[model samples]
Target: MSIVRNIGAEYQPGKGTAFTVWAPKATQVELSLKSNPQTRVPLQREAFGYWTGLSEEAVPGTRYMYHLDGERDRPDPASRFQPEGVHGPSAVVDHTSFGWTDATWQGLPLDQLIIYELHVGTFSAAGTFEGVIEHLPELQDLGITAIEIMPIAQFPGSRNWGYDGVFPFAAQNSYGGPEGLKKLVNACHGHGISVVLDVVYNHMGPEGNYLNEYGHYFTHRYNTPWGDALNFDDAHCDHVRNFFIQNTLTWLRDFHIDALRLDAVHAIYDTGAKHFLQELREHVGQLEEQEGRPFLLIAESDQSDVRLINPINKGGYGLHAQWFDDYHHVIHTLVTGEMEGYFEDYGKPDQLQKALEHTFVYNGLYSEHRKKTLGTDATANPARQFVVCAQNHDQVGNRMLGERLTELVPFEMLKTVAGMILLSPYVPMLFMGEEYGEQNPFLYFVSHTDTDLVEAVRKGRKEEFAYFAAKGEAPDPQSEETFERSKLRRSYTSDPQQQKLREFYKALIQLRKTHPALAHPDKPHLRVKLDSEKLVLHLTHTGQEPHLYCLFNISNQPQKTQLHAAAGPWKPLLHSADTAWGGPGADIPEMLQQRATVSLPPASVLILELFA
Candidate 1:
């Protein structure tokens, strides 16, 4: 197996450190220590726009910057730790120094992942990497197999969403830096939970961005909503690709991250024979083989393109999975009755049924919102290849008021939605406070220092929400109050209603893991049907003995639905409207026969297990 070499300052034990950087735009590159600016070491320019040098003075914990052409100074683009925010000098870190106890961890399989997404800054009172470790026991007990953290790369300031990260290699200084992140991952592995880091390679943020001064990292050939797209297929693109590919390997090989959630892959434009994602997967596969552990590459894609997850041999970019937003749009619109933006295409009971059955409601269908056809058929993909969620960061935080599902619909409906998501065949992910229903709005917040850039962000947010029905001006994105308000109110978990909801989620997850039919996603044996008149959904899993039948009543009024199961006796497994879940009552019969008429309560869900 070939060892992967990092491009930043690599600490050599007993010796000094070897520093390498790609500075194609500079005529000369010099390393200057922050502790003593007078000390400078000139680096030798190498082939392919790279500069290399050995500096005995530059050791671990030393802060340094590159002096470009004797004119201006800038931080290392691949700095492992930005100790003093994004604008400060970069600090050298020894990757082997941290003591890790997860040598025996084999990592969780893709199908077994029950992901809980959280923002590091707002996940706890401390709002740091170490702060997240305190909640691992609770998350483990809640049956979460993995935690998908939002991006932690150093950004303009502490409060902004990680998508605005400018330094792809450095860990955010405000969130305890590189050491803090390693500790969090170590603790998670000890608790039998995997870690998935969300990384942004689509575009660099406006503030504190210095990549352009180094090399051709961005190209104007294609445009993304965020900013100039990464130069994946433009001039001098090989080095740019290597820069990101090395970044991807560094996270897995050095940091021991189990998986990476590629942010907004739909925005990645590459026309080369071998796509960037494919090359990334190839490199990850090699590393995975060397480490003898599973390393998954999941994408957050808006386009339901099967090519993203298709096998490489079949002329497709091989990926483990992609986020299924069609399910969220269908369920959110169906429950809230909101019909604006992308929600305009959903809001029907059949759409929810189609999403569950085919994995995409807009597969090869014309999108009225886009005024063109969008998405391809994803029905042939494995069920586990699609990650479904009722509410995620983008769904909640991007809203005009950042209102959670708890704030939009009735309390009883919350149970129904949880049941639908948890019991589905696809992998399920829960947002930070959604297990018990967090009430605090996850408002968009930023801490950029540039006044003009801050104003542009404020203006952009207002126009993004113009089509929505939400009234009132959006809270200031640059305000500290907005960041504080987005923090999860952990105290809410103590409330009786919240406690019951938490218990319901725990039970559903337990069942999903233990039940024969639910344990494995046997899509071939799955069936779904919708009764538009009664506003009921019927789902059946007949892959294993003791089949499962799930019924969801989305309307406010109670609805009667016929059982669609083989000849057998059906027993009540879980009912959302039961008294145990703090619902009105359990109106469904205790024992259900095949083809029997079942009465479902308003806005409730019922799961039945059949015995032959």
Candidate 2:
């Protein structure tokens, strides 16, 4: 059956509103309004375990809840606006009321997407969706084409990473509800920036999750890190699948979201003939055809399975792109020289070269961390199919103190890391405050009302960071101070060094957009060579005219390397070690000949354009 779009309270202009909810477990369900609790309307139970009713008095501003079997009152499973909190009544939202200014915005192609991921609360001082809109101009000026926002679904409190969202449809009350989110999306499109929302579909948050009371939303057949897994393959799973599919459509159709970044797809266990991702992709494709615009699905998976991004006709899930952490792992380990937990599987200089040429370094190889063969060869996939980054929420926030790369690495190494990520043949993403050197930590935090649940979260965080126990005790996840500390200081303009770093990032972004070799992801014509002894990486992009030669010196000492370029004069394009960029000095000559020996400065990167 086709998916239903109007699952919750859908308001009609002249003809009141219609409410539909899935409640298979309840024999009787009544709609109770929050404004007047005495007024109750009984809904008729429809086939396939759904309740439907129409209320003339239930206006757009009316807040309501579903009373099941005259026993319990719970918020709608598909709430659009949770004004009070996750535990409060859901408000009726008039999606048509908001006037959007982006009618001409179609969307950006995968090749042209330079994503900047940010958390709405920490991104701005106001800590609301409108607050994020305030910085759209600054982001556009930085050459960002899209912003991948962390999950904003209705979680418990105002301060959170947003992964514990319980209401799939409702926008968080603290971050400014549904209307606030719409305004931000509308503003983003107006600025020619596509919005990619991070969504959690594997499991609901433990605190205010009421889906189990409505129907068989979770199953014991499989287990996830959050206990019972979503019922994607179990019995009575069609309705549950429809619930999520409708949520996807609501965002794309109603909210005008350009894409969705599915958080942690590895935790989603579905063994059906048609996997949940495939079904969701099919629905999204149908919407794309109807809307005449592009809609993308980017998955975050640790499996490194090519099937996730492979075409459905080729026996795969057919997702557009995925977060490729192998590249980040190799780069982080090489720069930090710290091998703990999953970092044990990385750190070889050859692996960095492999990740640049090929997508994955552990393709069908036994992983020292997993103790088993993991991943498939991803060389067949296009480079744009992988979204790589130097640092992200998981890479930074997962640390004991949530220290960013700026705090972990030196100033020169920071420039080198930016060069490696932006110049590589893939879609590049930058975490918030990464453009400049924001020193504040992006720690894990939560604000659950249940004392026991809060304690459990604190204990889980401590155990998660057991590898870094010697770094001192982790900050309390339930503390408001932790969330406050994660906020960006926005000191790039005031701080001279940070301003220089920001300029360097802008220059790299411009190069990525304008340079022939960096503009396109021609993996077949890209060649990579690594010297583990000298800690130097040489990359040649020969796909386009006037081939480009790149060098990265990751060592602390300068290394002399031979430039194996074509028999022509090569002009220096961008040198990270140039004195103009706060580096010591440029050691390479102004003009380079073929097979010329040049000194590469310590912790520096150089890009040269070959001229025939």
Candidate 3:
């Protein structure tokens, strides 16, 4: 295994851009400037298959391509910016050029974020980084604190889900590349908003992945469909680990990203004494200490392991937060009746009650599908887990047809999920187009040079189970139409339901910001009452001028329910079934509001306030 002497070349910012690409077996490596052959410089690589060079003219916004031994032209896997798309030249950016005013902006703690996940391609019709920025005002009005962007790394062609990224360090040129992304981030921060970058470290894309030429970055001990596993625990693991860690910090330091949502951590597969997640957390903590800026790491794992989000001092990874699927499955099953695979395990309101109250319903209980007890509960730890209605890239792209929750659930149900997510103490997330209910679907896409793989993807989509396994007759992921369709329809911003939904979301977010009782979950204050088909969440805070309460009706029929509240001065704050949301429910107090008796319409949720 060849040692990586210059892993720093991929991320360290500067005027003289120095890049170190691992192409060990190749006889020669040349950095070719786009449309210019005279500037092609030969790389200086040692015995370890690592080729490196420092360029004085490779300034920010400059474009270039990589030529291997006078071979065919190829895009740089580490290209910083691509203004002309994936096939375009690499750009050199001065990470310090952009002035950021978030001096006191300690980013949204993962615990407090009402995350709105969006795909730049699908979030707007323009399908570019700059296009997505146009909707920041709308998102701000929609009551979102952070925008968790899907991967922006360069891939083979125009369209992709970003999971097929080959360029670990570069942004897609077609989407206006690095500068475009920086502009969007700057804009988000200007609006007092934070950004979270979704990074994939599990495996490289099938195409444009020439890293094998450098050294043993992958091990054959375990093989995934994506190919070799990253050598996280074996020999030459230090440099490989640094390669990822540096990329992780670069998003924070250069892009001003508040947090990183680590994708598919279970596939990260680090079997070492000091796990990569722990080390990464330590590095981020150190950076946070030096910069005096609050940053968070949100891990995506299905192991139901507490160590992923546990405190670092407790011999755990100490990540700030993690994605909770238990909450998603419960809510998805209840609303959509999608009990095919794993949803079969969570169709009951009782499941949602446990998820809403205790964080996880399957607390070491027997899972009928897994045929074993899943895992232990989060132990009443609500702050460490983020639950939400939808997140960009995952739910949208996971479907066989790339359908969003908006397509399956009614507008009223959308409000219901939004209320349930926002009112809960846990961090909430929303997918792009969810605020206004976009009609487009978020389909799985990719741009691979190999025609065989493209055909395989089309065939794969025709079959359904998980995302990659959807085997539907699909469009060519590399096609221009596919990429174009991913862009969000900005017109939804003006729709009536869109406006109404936006206000409701904003109200909930504002409520969360103003209320302390909604910040974190404690045992006594939070409790959920539910039947087989209906649920009512009752919450009360300690020590205040009043208390917090939210009543939810998950059934398909209007139901009259009773609650355990003193009901001295009770008033309805908001309802999902109001006429604004196209409901016929009346505002006239039911039973004089003395004992808090009210009629909840089908698939509706109500948030109430008690003034003591």
Q: Which ten contiguous residues of candidate 2 have the minimum total lDDT?
A: 1-10
In order of appearance, the predictions have TM-scores of 0.98, 0.98, 0.89
Model 3: runs farther than 4 Å from truth? 1-19, 22-58, 61-77, 82-89, 390-392, 465-479, 482-486, 490-494, 519-524, 533-545, 566-569, 587-596
* lDDT (tens digit, per residue) of candidate 2 on 392-449: 9988998889999998889999999998998888899999999998999999999999
User: Best candidate, lDDT-wise?
Assistant: 2
List where candidate 2 sits over 4 angstroms from the true fold. 1-5
lDDT by residue (tens digit), candidate 3, 293-381: 87888888777777887777877898877888888888788788888766788887777767766776777888898888876668556
| lDDT at residue 597 of model 2 (Cα atoms) | 86
Clashing pairs in 2: none
Per-model RMSD to reference: 1.7, 1.2, 3.6
lDDT against the true structure, each candidate? 0.88, 0.90, 0.72
Distance from true position, residue 2, model 2, in Å? 6.4
Task: lDDT for model 1, please.
Answer: 0.88
Q: For model 3, what is the error of residue 60's alpha carbon versus the real structure, in angstroms, after optimal superposition? A: 3.8
